[model samples]
Target: MQFENTLEFAQRLDKQDTLNSYRDHFLFPKVNEKQVIYFTGNSLGLQPKNAKKYVDEVMQDWEELAVEGHFYADKPWWDYHERLANPLSKIIGAKPSEITVMNTLTVNLHLLMVSFYRPKGKRYKIICEEKAFPSDQYMLQSQVRFHGYDPNDAIVEIKKRDGEHNFRIEDILDTITEVGEECALILIGGVNYYTGQVFDMKTITKAGHDIGAFVGWDLAHAAGNIKLELHDWDVDFASWCSYKYMNSGPGNASGCFIHERFHNQTEIPRFEGWWGTSRETRFLMKPQFEPMPNADAWQLSNAPILALAPYLASLELFDEVGMDALIKKRNLIVAYLEYILKEIDAQVESTFEIITPSNPKERGTQLSVFLHGEGKKLFEFLMKNGVITDWREPNVIRLAPAPFYCSFEDMFRFGQILKQGILEKNSELSS
Candidate 1:
């Protein structure tokens, strides 16, 4: 598909977009009076209009039923989180029983690791990328130290080659083989937050399993953004937050996937609670912890109804428009964004570099632009000009044209504003 760097071309594309109706479903922040160009959905997605109604429904249940809401209210609170499992299963490509909506991403990471990261004797090292998300880094470090191993020795970080923006898949495979004997677990982001590189989870999972190591993913950015088949890929465990691409809201509940192979195996250890016990036996007040035969056995506590309402609202959209539809729009729009950004890079005196993988298969909607000369200042310029993007450390602007809400015209306008900001900065330098 050819792309032209013109407003008319963008408008034409928008007119033809099948998912264009979804844009009206979300609430965007305003700049002056008009809507801002929101490219920060990779950080916090815009609220769905139905979110309020969902929350109110939950609130109404609480108000009317009080404690009876657990069993007899509309949408029983006892089974609230389960409502998300089926819809979420569709998005992540897993068996409904293999998925559960629960705590936040990092908390679920810790919980999943409790069962998966069983380091015995010499097979104690954890393999991960050098630049994992800070939460993952901290969790890995603490987990390694908790098992009485030096973090530097027990944690193997796969590094990219010098001056490269992302890690090579071959290098990742080689590292897995090299550390196969000593490695206990392999954990990595499905889509890297900074570079937006999507790892080949299927190949990585096979490589890790071949080496007698468990493989897990922190799918904070990948869960809803990319097409995932965690069960078919044989991903041992994975977790993701709902606020970002899932468009739940700020600090909403997250989802977890534990392969069915791990289910019904009480031999595997987990930090258990009453909620994890079988629903039939839970009311009996049995001191013994007989875990559920599914992924819900990992739940430490009952559902947080208020926190989950928005997530359920959002997942309904995901279930309505499957990943195939979202990815179709995602690739074309992202390509258009790439084309326009490259055009800006070519035309501007002060330039930016897109650090994300060029191949759509290796990325999602995110495009990380590493600004050279006066780029940090340009971030502020973009914000003041009503472009809602994210600024990373040093000088990278992470922009995600989220498929649900962002339009082709938004990409064109963003490019024009970014060029304007760069040109103005260059002029300031000259004067």
Candidate 2:
């Protein structure tokens, strides 16, 4: 796609977008009572207008039916989570039974690790990317400690070769080869939160399987931003928060996936609770844990219907638009953002670089911009101006133009703000 500089380019792209109507569906933030250019979907997605209505339905069910709402209310709180299964499955490309709506992202990550990360005597190590989200790093470390293994010895972190922002796939594969025998699992973010690099999940899964290891992913950044085929990729399991690109709101419940092959397998031990028991027999209060034969078997508690309703509403939108179409639109918008950023970089003397991969295939909707000097100042300036993006510690600003609502015009406007912020910072430094 040729890079063009004009509002017409963005307007034309918007005109052609099938999902353009989705912008009106969200409640964008306002600056001075005017809608700001929101590009921070990597942190929190704009709330869908239907979210309130969805929540209201659940609230009404609870109010009218009381405790009976569990089994008797409309959509039934008992099976409310199940209602989300098919739609969530569609977003991540999994069999319906292979996925389940459950706990938040980090908690689900811990749960998945418990079932999938069993390490035998020699194969006790787990491989992960360096600079993974703090929550994931903590989960892995705690899991290793829980298993009576030293994390420093049992967790192998793959870092970028001297001064690089992202890890190369070959380096990851080689690390697996070098440590594959001793590795019991590979838990990686599908897209790196800091660099916006979308790892090759298929290849990573294959490498881990070759080493007799279970492989899982944290799709918090990649879930709705990228096209995924977890089951087809032979991914053993995965988990993700819906609040990011899924637009489910802050602290929304997350979803998980387990390979269909594990559906009926009793060998994998899960931390079970009553909600995971078979729905028909659950009311009987049977002592034997008769888990549902799928990812639902991993559930440890009842679904939070209030937290989940918004996600259900969002998934319906995804089901209508489809992942392929969303990703196609994302590629164009992100490419436009990248083009504009490059122009800014070329025009300015400041040391700003886009750490995200130039190829759209290797990334999702985010661009991680690395500022050589005064990163925090530049970030603050952008935020104050209402170009809302997220600032990671040390030096990166992650901008994600989520396809569901973010526009090419938003990206262009944001680029202008970023350029202006950089100029201001340079002027301050010179003075």
Q: Pick the candidate with the highest TM-score.
A: 1
User: What are the models' TM-scores?
Assistant: 0.99, 0.96
Q: In candidate 1, what are the lDDT values of residues 41-65, reduced to their tens digit?
A: 8999999999999999988988898
Computed on alpha carbons, the lDDT of every model, listed in order, comes to 0.92, 0.88
Query: What's the number of clashes in each of the models?
Result: 0, 0
lDDT of each residue in 310-412, candidate 2, tens digit only? 9888888888888989999899888888888888887777767889999888999999888776558788888788888888877988888888898887777
lDDT of candidate 2? 0.88
Say which candidate scores most in lDDT. Answer: 1
Positional deviation of 317 in candidate 2, in angstroms? 0.8
* CA-only RMSD, every prediction: 0.9, 1.5
Q: Which stretches of candidate 2 lie over 4 Å from their true place?
A: 426-431
Clashes in model 2: which pairs? Answer: none
